[model samples]
Target: MSLRDAWDRFTASQAELEADDEQLEARRRGTQPVGRCHARSRATVSGVIRAVTFAPAAAGPALVAELYDGSGSLDLVWLGRLEIPGIEPGRRLVAEGMITSADFGRTHATMFNPEYRLLAPDSAEATP
Candidate 1:
């Protein structure tokens, strides 16, 4: 699905799902699921990589990417080591994931468990 379509679905479905303070807090702190987020969606966003952070744990590593589209921005977090080639600040990317509110506070939306595809400067289609 197109990015616009996905955003619409997200907004429309958001009101149907509810989460208490504890759940939101855990998701915000990266300790739990943000809410009752759906795993499948056709929506996606193409944006520039504004920031990247790596959170290492005993089990594995988690990568968080801050992406900004023209309308807004969202945090994309991957739970495992992701081989994202050509990933850097200023690089464009198309990501697929579920939108969830920040667990710490109602600051902004985040894309959890993202499976991203990098789009090259000259490539027509996105690549993993």
Candidate 2:
């Protein structure tokens, strides 16, 4: 890498670097950034699964995953499911569903039982 590129990388914060990488991946996959998605609108977003949590609710078991796509994170919730095959941290995928902000205009946005496709592990074949 060039000296200027190295300098920029060294000066950038960890979050900035991660955001840049996520944005690049989103662009390459032609998926919408999670931060740009509006409430109550249907959107297709691509990102890496950061965390997965299994919480038992009154209705049923819920699997919630935090998907970060550089710009922001979206919570993917699957009701009545304890686990899903290939749903884990560090996996990349594209999900589509109606966006909802349960916190009333707060930073939290969620998609319930979104239609998703798991991507390959490498950069190659990452596009759908």
| Model 1, residue pairs in steric clash | 6-43, 24-103, 28-103, 28-104
TM-score of each: 0.55, 0.87
Residue-level lDDT tens digits of model 1 in 45-93: 5666788878676767877777765345667777785545566777766
What TM-score would you give candidate 2 relative to the actual structure? 0.87
- Candidate lDDT scores, in order, read 0.58, 0.90
Question: Each model's RMSD to truth, in Å?
Answer: 12.8, 2.9
Deviating ranges (above 4 Å) for candidate 1: 1-42, 57-60, 104-107
The ten-residue window of minimal lDDT in model 1 covers: 16-25
> Candidate 2, clashing residue pairs?
none
Model 2 ranges with Cα > 4 A deviation:
1-7, 103-107, 124-128
Error of 1 at 82 (Å): 7.2
